[model samples]
Target: DVKVTQSSRYLVKRTGEKVFLECVQDMDHENMFWYRQDPGLGLRLIYFSYDVKMKEKGDIPEGYSVSREKKERFSLILESASTNQTSMYLCASSFPMGLALDSSTDTQYFGPGTRLTVL
Candidate 1:
């Protein structure tokens, strides 16, 4: 079974602080993604990594960055956190896209999420 875990379930930060969100997957998936979920905007991809040390910016990546130095671990960094960046951050993992023989293999397993509050 695939399992994903986030470093925190809830966090509080002040404006302009550097924040690091960590995620880990036990399934050895080849792809990992970071998303921020807002009330009406839904899940917006912040960053995704297809392999170790390889990252691609997603829809909203201006204030965020990612690292995937190890296969099982991925980290999301908020360089200078701001109040506007407060949201529920999610971490997900899945097998490499298009390589799944069945639809189930392509499913992304998500963590419980870290709700960050920037004040």
Candidate 2:
């Protein structure tokens, strides 16, 4: 079974602080993603990595960055936290798209999420 875990379930941060959100997957998936969920905006992808050390900016990546130095771990970095960046941050992992014959293999397994509040 695929399992994803976040470093924190809830977090409080002050404005302009550097925030690091850590995620680890036990499934050895090749793709990992970070997203922010908000009330009306839904899940907005912040970043994604296809392989170790390879990252791509997603829909909303202005204030966010990602690092995937190891296959099982991915990290999301908020360079300078702000109130507008507060949201439920989700970490997900999945097999590389089209790598498996079954489409289900491409489905992402998500973590419990870290709700970050920036004051």
Candidate 3:
């Protein structure tokens, strides 16, 4: 099974502090993603990297950015952590098991998310 690791399970930061969350995947998959889940609203993507040094902004990329210096590791950076940014951050990866998405049985497996609490 593919294993994804998050740098933290919980983080508490004061407002305006820069925050960094790290993620690593061992599957050597071609895709890595970062998302934040909030109450009422479902998971919203922050950014995704298909390969090292390659990144695409997801639905919500405002206050957040990502780095993929190595294929096995991806990092999410918050320029200024705020109370509004306090949410569950999840990291995910996907790989092709066979051919197409449905036929390949490729599914995104998420990490045990990091919960951020800002005051």
lDDT digits (tens) for residues 80-101 of candidate 2: 9999988999999999978855
lDDT of 1 at 18: 98
Off by over 4 Å in 3: 96-105
Point to the candidate with the largest TM-score: 2
- In candidate 2, the residue pairs with backbone N, CA or C atoms under 3 Å apart (3 or more residues apart, or in different chains) clash, namely none
Give all candidates' CA lDDT scores.
0.95, 0.95, 0.91
RMSD of each: 1.2, 1.0, 2.2
Model 3 steric clash pairs: none
Angstrom error of the Cα, residue 67, model 2: value is: 0.7
Task: List TM-score per model, in order.
Answer: 0.95, 0.96, 0.91
Q: What lDDT does candidate 3 reach at residue 85?
A: 93
Q: How close to the true structure is residue 76 of candidate 2, measured as C-alpha lDDT? A: 100
Error of 1 at 7 (Å): 0.1
The deviation in Å at residue 47 for candidate 3 is 0.5
